[model samples]
Target chain A: MEGGVYLNLPKVAVLTMEGTNNEEEAFQSWRGAGANAEIIHIKKLENKIRKLEEFDAIFFPGGFSAGDYVRAGAIMASRLRATVMRDIENFVDAGKLIMGSCNGFQVLIELGLIPNIGGDYEREAALATNLSNRFEARTVYLKITNNTCPFLRKFRINQIIRLPIAHFEGRFIPANEDLLEEISNNNMIGLKYVDPYGKEVGYPWNPNGSVLNIAGVCSKSGNVLGLMPHPERVFNKYTQSDWPRGNEEDYGQLFFKGAVDYLNEKF
Target chain B: MKINIIVTLKDNVEDAEGQSVLKALHLLGYDEVSNVRTGKVYYIEMKGNDLSKGYEFCDKLLANPVINKCKVERDD
Candidate 1:
């Protein structure tokens, strides 16, 4: 490692499991943001081979985890809940960071980490199948709803950015109207799907038809973030689909860099 | 002992898969069908004949209360 600030870089774990194919991208993105990152399999945590306490941040990348058997992230979430539930709670209690994108976002909802209004990790939302009844794979414009989240601190509130989203079940449905209201009342929403003009729209614009056009959600404390877009997949300007048309923003790296910066300052 | 569990999506949630099937059925001239919803069934074999274990499985992993409701049946 280099001298100076690199001497105490934040450690990030890119958690993965069977069918989760994006760990490599997640690991590289974190490393690109000046963090010590490792791709750790979920089995390592389940078997007690790796400890969550060893890492400053955990990232669940996008993929069809556990084959998306019963649901997009049901099996993986259940497995994690069975083994590392308490450890995850302790990790959150310590004000550490956790970010999940795409299927990883579904896993966080399944694990009751995002929009955890009850504060007991109760499953309060489900990302059902898209209203189009088809798998959506495309670049989407997302308006940053809240920037207080550790993962979104680098972005300005209400700023619209483009990110790629690919998933079958990406619709965000809270348990009830009251819970949905509570999520908004608590400022847990992080991003909303928007048109190129930054207007909240439906169908092609909101890819999944998520209620309220919610594209991402954060926990009450803003340490945990779950979103359906794959920011890790587009760590550089060239990877973005429209970059060839004179676009030059490396938005993906900012999400990781923001979390790394937060970890460095707080821990 | 054998236990059977049927898990179904709650009424409030949109059943996209079921809706797709319904659309296909309508295209096939099955307009008589008004609604369609899909679900899953799981069969488990347990050494002990306690029905509570089946419910426990549903609570733990078989079904998520946020979107699904499960029914457990056991044969003793």
Candidate 2:
């Protein structure tokens, strides 16, 4: 239970494709937190399927892949479906951790990797263009939801974590009333927008019109996590815009730590 | 065959961009408008005999279930 005691630190593989650019940041975050991490290119994935079985966790990082053509993560998700999507499903089914951030989160939604907004297992939550219809780059406060998601187990409920979110399509929208209700009832609401004072407020603070200010969610088993924020960007103290006075010691780093801790416990 | 696809937010759903557009319209002296919502239109040309198949393509592939709803029309 000691901090950074990744005695069984899970081997993590970050999926990289033609345009994915955050794999290195993610690798560094995990590695700095004491987990073994590596970046695996999409072309090499076919030859590394067997090696994937040895890892305890896998991640998809953010980037403008394939020029975000045909919708943000559409092409990449389709490619994954063609290749190792089934393997990812198997890994999740086996109770291993799978994470997607930013564009990666979009891919998860597009591929039906994470549960959708409703419809039991296939509920599709909404991720769309920002209200401003332009790319937004800013640091936002997030209120972590009180959920049983393994990726967030170590964090306290309603914790106000400052993380930088840069994207054009981070708004989450649930398609219907039933879907919205299901997302609420199941505690699938993982992260929400909040004020710097730790209060759940509206607009600009939320940055996007995400329903209920949701910023992240996990699969029913809490093994699959998809988030719009970029924790990798904030792994280092110097990366934070308001480092010292904010007294914020890299909330993003804690995220990787939490994941590694979970893996160490399970493995 | 020519097909028209219309995409809109579900009813009662808030449209932030549309609201801003309405504000702009009001400022432009178009006071007759009471409400406004923004949507997308897609025109597609297909070389096929079956119209239903083309409609299916719009529903399954083009539009996403999360934020969009699409309607297909064929100009016969």
Of the true interface contacts, what fraction does each candidate have? 0.70, 0.33
Each model's DockQ score: 0.75, 0.33
- The sequence of per-residue lDDT tens digits that candidate 2 reaches over residues A1-267 is 454664456789898888888899999988987788888877777666555677889888998877886567877777766677667777877888888899989888877766644323342755777887668888889888954787687688888888888888888876677867776787888898899787777778988777788889787678888999999988987898778676666678877888888887888
Highest TM-score: give the candidate number.
1
- lDDT scores in order: 0.91, 0.78
lDDT for each residue of candidate 2 in B1-76, tens digit (9 for 90 to 100): 8887777766555677788889899999999988888877777787876767655654444556666666767776
Show the colliding residue pairs in model 1: none
Top candidate (DockQ) = 1
Query: Which window of 10 residues has the lowest lDDT sum in candidate 1 chain B?
Result: B55-64
Instruction: Identify the runs in model 1 with alpha carbons over 4 angstroms from their true place.
Output: A2-7
Expressed as tens digits, the lDDT of each residue in A125-206 for candidate 1 is: 9998899999999999999999999899999988889999899999999999999999999899999999988999999999
Worst 10 residues of 2 chain A by lDDT: A114-123
Error of 2 at A189 (Å): 2.0
